[model samples]
Target chain A: MKRITHFYSLTPEWQHSFAKEMGGELIDNKIIVIPEDIGHGYSYFTQVTPGISVLYVDFVLDTPIKITRQKSDNELYIFHFDMSEHVNLIRINKIDYRIGTHEDLGLAIIDNKMKSTFKPAVGDRTLAVRLLVDKKLLDEFIKTHPSEEHGNRKISVPKKSLYYYDHIDSHSMLLIRSIKDRSVFDSSFESYLKGISLRLLGNFLDRYEHSQAVKDEITDVEIESVTKTQTYLLDNLYNPFPSVPFLSKMAGMSPSKYKMIFKKQFHNTPKNLFIEEKMILANRLLQSGDYKTLTEVIYELNYSKLSYFCSKYYELFHRKPADDLVKKKYNQKCITKSTLQ
Target chain B: MKIIEHSFGPDLDWLPHYAEQLGGKIDGNFIIAPDNGIRYILPCGEGISAFYVDVTYNSDFHKIQKNRDTDFIGLYYNLTDGEATLTARDFMYNVSRWHYNLSVIDGLINTDYVVKSGSRTYGLAIFIKKSIIESYAKKENIVINQIEEITNPEKNTIIRFDRMSYDSYYILEELHKQKVGGPIFDFNLAGTVHLLISNYLRKLSTNKIILQTVNQTDLNNIILIQKYLIEHAEETFPSIKQMADMANMSESKFKILFRKITGSTPNVFFMENKLIKAKELLEEKQYSISQISDKFHFTNNSYFTSKFKEYYGLSPKIFIKHL
Candidate 1:
């Protein structure tokens, strides 16, 4: 670990999300976008090289890095990823920084920088890992995303597992180190995406899940119940939502503590989360072509203000629910009743 | 063949009251009537095969479990919560398909499908078979084409497509529509699957895949292994060295003809496979810029997210939720 001053450009996600509003570029090409959120955190990143020329950012946040998302609406996003492969080397920066989950979320590095990647020296370039995830869906993800436990181990990571090259050394980690931490392209404007390869992740989860801290505190049953609660919230998004007090009673968590844990784990207010859920349901519902106006969705969700609901929907989704109806041109029956084919 | 009785409840004696289908699970004790014969019993949520393995149950599962994608992901979502008024049977019925339906997955290619771009995956997995064009090529006599079968193919390649592609829809509207009879492997909606399989085999013969010693089972494992490598390079480094270490074999022998079996060099395979997770996260718009970066172990947020934008011509976030 070398001590030096360091700066890391915001991952391309910020630009990707705000590209139309704010365009930018990358440095060193060391970063890779994970293409997923850290659930309650911002996103994922990694380091590629052990090069001395690069400046590295400290993982501990004695300092605050200001991050800005599109100023449309408040959205809560969830991302679950694993970085146990890379050796986690926490270093002392002597810099007073408290990294908050509300900001860039969790970032794990693989480099053997146990000493210092950035300190004292004003300019230091550090190796970085990269990842990629969709933004707009994340915005909408703020809505209705459930606070679920990490159960099913599809992709298994070993417990407290860290890789330091005992194998043929494909330098496979090198490629992960290679991709820049920026959004590749916002070219495809897709309203939906299906990940066929998700099944592979099951194994990674299967292996590492046994040792991770998530398993230690919450029970699988508790996680399941949380998921159920989220589902119920989505189903009734359009109706007057149950109060947090009532919801806490239902989930068996006290209202105050539930709010704290839920937000810490999921990074969304229950109400905001509920609104997001209703918005998604609204999308599916509006797709059915039955609801002709955004006003109807607002009415369905039992919002106090129609404009507030519409604006909130736009912020969460970065699009209008009514707009989908206009584009599809098929009324509710046609949209919902279409053959599954 | 007789399908055995599979039901689950909290107690071993709780039987004769419920029936379960393929993958139908309960938050209680598990029961199975094995097709291989005899009754197999285990606790709920166990991955035990009909023989040998015992189900793993713990009071702590509620804490460790995250999200799940199963027929009953919604049912076991919350167990023993006093509000779980509905019976497990009803929930099963809701997500359960009396008979599984097969459809070709279709949507805007990038929107509905994903190709992994990380190290942890096997090989390229087409969400819906891209053999639509090849299927047409086969029917029209393309001399360059041939089909090969996988005996114990890679599980990644063996995955199911949940929707029909637009091309298949075009073929379906024009051709005679009929149900695919017999085994799941026999079904071909637009000949896309068969063509895809054949193309895979042909590629195996000529391209990166080498037959090695011509052993059939190894060939299948190689194919599956190739798929696994192709789909998860970013997240995995199960190289010849890793496997050799696991199996206590020499790396030299492992490297000599490794490519002969899978076709591509391990390094290339690793790179290609990593994309699967990267691409999947890139399309699921719910993730933030940095979230995607860390999932695949991109060292730098700026670099990872930038590469993502460069690869797809849009940031991971914008590309999926396209602004």
Candidate 2:
């Protein structure tokens, strides 16, 4: 294992130091392509706007590499997105944290004062996007756009070093995916990236404000329970929604406490999440075209009564199952017709 | 008809001007529409501004005249059902629905258009400083023909009349579906506008699209054919020979002119509008799939399903999931 240490910053000096440590050469004054001996891919850095910069690193390591950033006095917030093909691992102030599996992707925000180390799971592609933003700028934005939780109150950042990590909401995730999927059109790529960066910053500030308003400290044990409950719900989506009491008992917590913690952690009610997932699954099944009739789909998912299933599906997806079936068949027919022609 | 004159540019200060004219109040970056719809004005950057409006006028017709003091390049996207006539000086064009709807014009002079009411008017306008675009073009070593023409500054020369490609359409859809509020909403709107501008620039970079000014009479004929098709969307599509005869032109000439103006064949245009109309009926929830197919004069339900799926990427039955 090779370990590299550097003082924290998103400037040329810091980028050069990291590049040198990784035995790579800096190119175009903005990118450092990884040396073939160590990995494939490159790290790109850009100043989106004043007070906000983005550093995107993507590579697969032939050997394990750990990058450590020494604690600094700069008041900055690092919004890190780990989009690796597998689980992404990191340590903040000697506390270990693991995340970024496809099903469990999230954003991790760390205060600049805390020493942090990134230990990506190797032999697989490691993709990460980090936005370095000035704390003062973030505070200014929060003052103008107060979260619902902290309505009309003058919110301030506490003196304690902040380290918060949570699942990226679907909306934010969609924005991130759009950014990733964009092809570089040279003329306006910078402006395009800057626009996406602002969007991400805006979303983060809102989330941070809401997080600051919550006074209760969530424990590791509680997080574990909530995570386990989420996995259980996702796995049993085909089955009817397990009652709150049933889930709470499994999590070894009171029913009301469980519900509160679930909402706080996932930002969704248990029943709503279950229904949403069930509908999503139903959509996939209906699109698969293996099932000829909507009734077969309803029965396959343990649903009874075509009308009841249609209403629930409509409530969640706003479209009927029958339409999806016809859509599937129609698409197949078009494919055949085109080929024949 | 009501006349509403307005100007939009780099700053959002023009929002107040619009609010005062519309009898609405300005709320931060939004114009709280008095009753009909939503309006967002976003200042994207130093020399870029974007505006989005989705409203149905209480009046039957409104003629909006845009008069700008400064020279700016305006990228306008008209997404409403075809109910608009864009008049840039003497060159007049009817707004095509979705397809071939992007119009880029130099806003050096006064230009006005008429928008009919009773249906929603959804559109986005992006204003960019002409100097900024010139500097960008020079720095990037790319020359857009229309940009150079701006050196002499033709009064109302349209830079390009093109279709919104699939990518642009997807971005527009995302913009329409945006649900965030507050500063995030502002950022999302601005970011999306930049994306649209970026897409427009990318298309221009290829230098394939050029200034296309059609004859007024020819444009009028195309508009007439389009309106006729839209009106009879429920009926069977007229043959190209019949349409050509109706337009008083040869079949090949009529086909070429229609494809050039609309970016689609006549049959495709008719069927697309028909499917869209069928989608609206589906939203009404008054008819079953069979009933809609029968009403549309399709041979059978499966054929209707295939056509709907081909055009919408989802069968009418399943596409309702979004409604």
Candidate 3:
């Protein structure tokens, strides 16, 4: 993977590497564009404001391609607004986060060398708007528009890097609409794009600042321990999870405090989350067809009886485990018969 | 320190040019300070002129006087690290950091004084024309008796000074971080100016301490009544007769005093308080519209919805949707 810091520097490199695949022109000394190609529809760089830039992408590809880039040390924050029907999975620092259409906005804060991968499906159209903003500029903007808890403190750039998903609001939807609007005149197109882009940015910052304010109230140690507890739960999903007292002790907190803070962060009680994770794991295992029989699946998941496993699975998936196994087997048989024919 | 004077009003488009003449640099819609510090003069609509001063230099006395050719109220906000005296005619008053002052200025007798030195002085000043405020008061159907009194030709140039509250300080700090240009800059500047001015006027209207003639016991009772209304926001508001009995005054006298001290009728004050609380609840997004209306004791959801729209220019449902 190639590592680059500045956005402008990444552009020429992309143009060179994908010379035959994509070609683009520069605009206003700030924006670079790759006009519609044979497979790709359109992609353009728009400098929304002084410190904010947006890359509008619409692509229809013929084969699966994985494009990876290492973002060097810089102060840019990236936001991916997925507008397509399919989910786009992006990996940042080896963790995968799914950005779905109109459901959630993906946020990536790049402070150091971090790897990012973008994979689009073959023969499917994908549309997305990528916004890159200078962190200093955003921090300054947020300071003037202080949210509940983010008033006095400076935004912390975590060492490990961070990626999260935020819910889409109406303002974000408006921004997407404006970006997709193509009737703007060529003469005023740049300014028009800049105006709408900033408005979209303003909307994003408003929500971002409010959430940051809430996050500021949680102490660093508490955040670390909660994260630890989450990992522990995920690792022990098949086994009987530890009690609240035991988990709290591991996290250096009283049981009640741990439960309250855990619920506040994850929006679920420890036991409920344990059950949820177990059900998810069981579903994945069943769909993968690694376990042939119902008893095999139940034993693998550490359930004492088949009935207990089926009951829990039914509660989570609204279907019996045996039904899912039967469905998977029938689907495999149909695929084999069709391929053979 | 450079001293430059220019008369500005609602239609003055050349204000930015004049600002540039005073060692300030004009970049698009923003006026940047040269070497010394930063400054921006934004002419917000409704005849309200807002400007920021962040100058640091060495001088014994640098006076930036606005030769007011029309009736206007000058709101001064001192942010940090500066001491200056405001001298108008025979009266001289000292004002320093974290101080907020409101003054009514007329062209002939009331010359605005801003005494400064060679140290860094950060502050904001908003000049709102008398006509504009009067129109706003009429549109909002709110009483601004203090403004009327201060703008009277017979009255002296009334200068009322108060300490900056924490909310106001936080807002000022936020204003300092605005460095963009173009329509977005203007939009943020106008919104902030309106908010700051509204906050100051709200405080001035409600505060009884600025009224020197009011006795200590009456002032205390008025403050207590204000606090009582805020604490009992969900309860049935007290009638004028009931509140008068509590304050040991006649009903007519209670109504007059309450209006004078709070710059709003008791009923209007209570409604405004409820609306403020409603806005916070709407922002929280935890309750539905019906739940919030019931919690605030509104007669019905429609009535609450109408009142919320009238006050915030947006309905509760729409507001929550935007959130």
Candidate 4:
């Protein structure tokens, strides 16, 4: 395993050091495409605004590597979105945290005072983005959007570090996907990246503030159980919905209590979330073009009745399975026509 | 005409005060007009602000002018069903339906526009500071000297109008679908604005169409005719002789310049708009295929179906199913 040292500040020294350690050449002082021997993507870093900076990572490592950064005096809030196929393991101030790969929880926010080491899983692709924000600006932003119980719920950043592990909500995920789809070859790529970076930062701050206001209602132990149960449900999407009593037993609580806590955390009842995930999976299977027929898709997703499946799919996506099939066939025809042309 | 003047800048404090005069009240980041429409102001960051308005007035012919001193770029998108004319510097533009609806205007030049009452007008204005645009351009190694020259306050302002691409249209549709005051509404609004601005910039960088300096009077006349065509899309396209007389030009000259300015023949443009309107009606789910076909004056249902499929790559029924 190769150990790489890097820093988060937007300075030439930091860029040069990281590029040198990775044996990659820097381009235009902002991007460094990792050497082919180690990875196949680039790391882009830039200051989006005066008090906000972003570091975008999209690469797949062939060899094991660990990125270690020293503690910094520059007080900044780092919002990290580990959007990878596999989980990212990080150690911050001697506490190990596994981030990403769970739909319900993936993003992590940490203070710059804590030293960290990021170990990305090899072979699987790694996609992560980090926003470094000035503490003073964030503090001012918090003061403006004061919650109802702002007096006691205030997260005054004195000297102690703040760490928040949260879920990358569906909206943020869509924004992330949009950012990923942007082409670097475009002449106006930098401007587009900066604009989206500002949006992602704004979104993170809003979520952070809302989470702070609601922090007093839930206990840590309860949160742990809810997270465990949610992950379980997400992992078992192809299976039929587990009964309420069964899920509550897994979370070690009464069925009603489990349902309430699950709703509070995930913003949906457990059964609804399961069905939604299943429908999403079903849609993907239909669109993937691997299945031969609609019956195959239904069977793959463990659906008992075609009519029931179609109604649930419509309820979720506002389109029926037959519609998707028509679109797929139409798209295939267009592809063939273009190829012939 | 009721004349209203507004100062354009990053600060949106004047909006709520101005909305009050029009029988509206501020609700958080939104200005609510009980009978008119609602407007949202989202300040993304230091130098970026998004303003969205969907309003119609009881009174007729209100002329609004935006007053500004500093230079900036205003990315304006109009998705309206109304008659409006905008005059930015010397060039006049008709806010026509469907086609060429995105306007990239220079903020240094004052913009004046008049909107007819009783018709809904939906618009989004994203105000971006020139300094910020300069920084992005400089860092990206894109020489925007041409942009600077075109947007010079002292020179005659030349606004760039583009047909909003299908992708951008879908993005705006998604943004419009978002409910206000959700836990993540502000973030979503900012995100959508970011995508819109980025998409516009991408188009700006890759633009290849030469902006010919058409004669001002001829351009205005063409715009007027285009507006007429859009307003009467359901009706048959007028003959070339009548259209040429309307534009005060000979038929040969009319055919050449119409294609040059709008990138389509007059009849093609008319039919394109009719099909677009037909698609919208189909999405509304209020009319069937035969009704829409008859409404658009198509010969029959099969003809309408073929034309729709040829234009949009799917029959009306399938499009409805997909929707």
Candidate 5:
């Protein structure tokens, strides 16, 4: 049998076989499974807290892999935070959902079989944190202490359900970052991990309970179109910008309907989103020091007038492009001087 | 500014002078009216500390700095209509009401905290020493990299905001309502503080990703609508138009967002919440069937009984009798 390094390759009955194949040992009910000849990645499952456990997989993939796992009997709440730049496909309920880099925080319930294709932008690393919680414990707790204030109205974990948020809030981001921090592996490693795990679960549930109350009213087709519109806008940030009507046509919706759905999905109007994307790209280019001057950045962003570009840059970053350039140069000079010294 | 520090156990001398020292005049235990505001720090156990503060002033007058001797993680619970801003290094945060924030502070860093005036504010601050947290983490076998970073002497402070769970909120409310002081008071205070700490730790662990998918304005509106529903749970259910008007959202958008943020439609959510409250009242066994139904504004006892049975699969009388 071929070695199963990636998660998608493992079938339901392959767990024991794979464990034996990899010479993996179980510690505290957790099997550390390392695939044969896979150098940079390993996956492990550990029961950190009572009735709660985590399946932490970290890998730098060399080749793209389509992984599918059959949903088990027990209900599982999975929080997927992808810290990579590449977009991955997660198909659930016959809808292919796109999980973008750091931009999408996925809260999904896997009661039925599901498949996820992990395709990275060649050579780039894929670092994702997936937290799984037992549904019994969570549901029991919610049943006893129902709070309309906390938005704990009803939690129905269907066989296949997927929820995605565009951005993780600052607090959750910090906590997640803290989990990824490698410095704190002391004697209390297990306790610390459990503590962080439980806290992360609580935070996710709190937000999920509230946000899930507001169901994603858009259909799968609408979501796909909106997602496509978003991808098109991002891809053409530097190209001649398309009008709302043109993009709406691409989405197969009337211009007005398209704008409404797009805004609902992305939280920004098409025009504003386009400008934001351009400004982000421009900022990256400026910070990279690839563009020698502000004029170069303006041309790179396809802006005709330097003043208009500068104003837009100022509006976005609260500083002019020339000022940022000067600061960047000065900072670089200081770093160089320090290195030389 | 005056600084009053009292450690837990027998002596609480600093408690008496606490209000006065911080430019405040006290009416007995509570700080009545102050020239500005008052702060009282009461350290508890090994590495656990508590601070009680109430402020009402027009400007940012008091700047309370943590003593530079110990590094601690601060749990700040703000119960105020006004804003409490904490500025440390590059970040400035507005501490929202009824929400608890966990902050790891480097004693060496120049972190400034000020409560803006024009609103009366009351809150509790619990600070657990990094060593205590480390010790607890060790005992529990928890691996928190943030704790390691926070323990480092050179790193800046870290803060995360989270809402108070219903259980914790009730406990805090109970603690606040307890006016009597004695052995019972001490026991209650200690137990409540421990519960709050554990609650904070649990919250910290389960918060994986903080996604602000809903913008602040919408969130605030949703919160307002929820508060209205909860506060008037006994009253007649408000119409969707009334709720939308209150939230300043269009009726259709409001309905969609309300259901989106809350898993049930407006009427269902309201009815379910009302029934839940009715169950709680029934469990108390204080009120009669007619009184309970009247209180909840149910048209008749039969209607209330039907709804209660639908929710819990048991009649109110049966549930009460079993209890």
Candidate 6:
């Protein structure tokens, strides 16, 4: 009763709450309550009632979810859904209950069976004993027969397939806001989908941070700085061009402050992009077969001073550019090295 | 280069407080000036244009240009990204026919600005067509502030490359993690989107452009691999093992992923690959009974001939000239 904006209800209780009884009454029973409301993690559970039958549920609450956007933050919303994966017993902890919503309780199952059109068997028309929930568009799905598990005809959907159907009303935009534990939404629907997906990855190999304040008040100045910083990286691919000092000056920022903005947008230090940019260019050249020798490629990419470039190249290509160029060409482009298959 | 022109609300004021308060609704031209930068010239007086406000530099009346009284010809806009600002330089390209050349560098306002919203942050200057703006001027003046911006359903969720966030890096690493175990691994079926993320991450990590990440390329590689592996898995077959090694992937990982990507694992995939090879060879069934065995690289001519018989259920020679 503490103004629970999110609560994960058990399958049995959730199912029974909306279920009808013999006397045409909703089964309003005392629901099973759990006090162990943990804030965030993933929890799965399944439970059964003696005559009521078995019920199972799995939910993750307050857990970071990933969503990609092509653009930066032009809008925001929350995502909730009804999904299926069989469970034998109900055993939820604190995770799934945190951000749970009412629609999350039953939408998936309801959507799967509910219909909007009218149709009944002509030959086996029996005096229907009772009416289910709402009589509007939803009631159209009340089965002509109860015990039938799946629909009369099975529509085989493949793996990873998405099937979305809806009536005009009861529809609201659902936003996928966070990933793992980061907030990457900064731009538009067309520019930063992958960026957002990567930004949400908290348990990342490439550690990154998100600042709430900067996002709350994203000024034109900040946008300009980020843009300038990125452009420098693209242009200065093969230079000892700008250290943090030079880079910061280019973007009109203090070095320390520039690091924070860089961390948010690129998920690394300002110098990191420069570093990767070199390796990326070198890799492209190797794949393109531009270098006549390993020494030539190294000198051309200006890795003369830093041994880091070669080591990084080795890491990226899984081999040196000299030895890998022929293989890279054959692999990158499917021009046959041998006519014999 | 398709200039999509549409009218927003009638009360649209592009200049905001910058304009002299023209009592009722003031209509300013919804303008998005084409920038000087573009890969190539594809006509339309403008390049990729967007009508939006630069909320960062926007105060009131900062972005106002000509009044209804002026006969302005053409508009030129400049975007100073360093300040997160957009300023316009309006003039007539052909001033003789079009009377005015008023140059105003007004700061944009009121419209919600987009920051960090692309592959990288870029400053875009949008331009509206002169002819289009002139079409409406005869009846009433038009002022374009910023066209409505779209709200995102997926916000703050991005996957970027940075070596700082340990967790972000970890996700990429896990995706790169190789399973050396034998074929048959658990495949967690998330959804289409999840698989796409996983696939993109893997390709980026491998940095190997073996195949483009299109539906057909991914499908063909799976099919080809599956076909090549099938027939070679005989006796103490090393074909499946060799293929996985060729890919520099764990046998189990390769098998499970291949099955998921296609519908067959290393062994079954090998069988399919082999079956297809056998079909092609069967069509060319000629030469010698013994020579044909050597053609498919079978250990023994009889064995090759026998396997061919098992596969096609017909002797090699008869299956050959029959065509």
TM per model?
0.25, 0.60, 0.35, 0.56, 0.37, 0.20
Between candidates 1 and 4, the lDDT winner: 4
Clashes of 2: 6
True contacts kept of each: 0.00, 0.35, 0.04, 0.26, 0.00, 0.00
TM-score of 2: 0.60
lDDT tens digits, residues A1-341, model 6?
A: 11211112323343332222111122224222222241222211222111111121122323222211121121111111322211111112211221112222212111112212111112221111000111121122223212342232221121211121111111111111122222111111111222222222211101111111122333455657777878967887776646788778877768887777778767867666676777778777767665556666678777774366667877765776555653323253455544545
Residue pairs in clash, model 4: none
Can you tell me which runs of candidate 2 are displaced by over 4 Å? Answer: A7-29, A137-162, A179-185, A201-341, B13-15, B32-36, B60-71, B146-158, B179-181, B206-323
The interface RMSD for candidate 5 is: 17.5
For residues B147-233, could you state the per-residue lDDT of candidate 3 as single tens digits?
445334355444555554434554565556656454445545555565566555445444544543466477557656766787788
Worst 10 residues of 4 chain A by lDDT: A153-162
What C-alpha RMSD separates each model from the true structure?
Answer: 28.4, 19.1, 23.0, 20.7, 30.4, 32.5
**Model 1 DockQ class:** incorrect
Instruction: Compute the DockQ of candidate 2.
Output: 0.14
Poorest 10 consecutive residues of model 5 chain A by lDDT?
A3-12
Docking class of 5: incorrect
For model 2, residues B16-111, the per-residue Cα lDDT tens digits are 787888778888767886655888777776678888877776655555656554568888887877477677655676664533478776776566
DockQ score of the complex predicted as candidate 1: 0.02
What is candidate 2's lDDT per residue for A102-172, written digit by digit as tens? 53645778787888888877788877778888888867776786457554332343543435566664345
Q: DockQ of all candidates, in order?
A: 0.02, 0.14, 0.03, 0.11, 0.01, 0.01
lDDT of 4 by residue, B200-281 (tens): 7665565544333566687667767877887898987789899899999999988887877666789988888898788878
Candidate 5 structure lDDT: 0.59
How do all the candidates rank in terms of DockQ, highest first?
Answer: 2, 4, 3, 1, 5, 6
DockQ of 3: 0.03
Q: How many Å off is the CA of A124 in candidate 4?
A: 2.8
| Candidate 2 residue pairs that clash | A318-B321, A319-B320, A319-B321, A323-B317, A323-B318, A324-B318
Reference-based lDDT, residue A275, model 6: 68
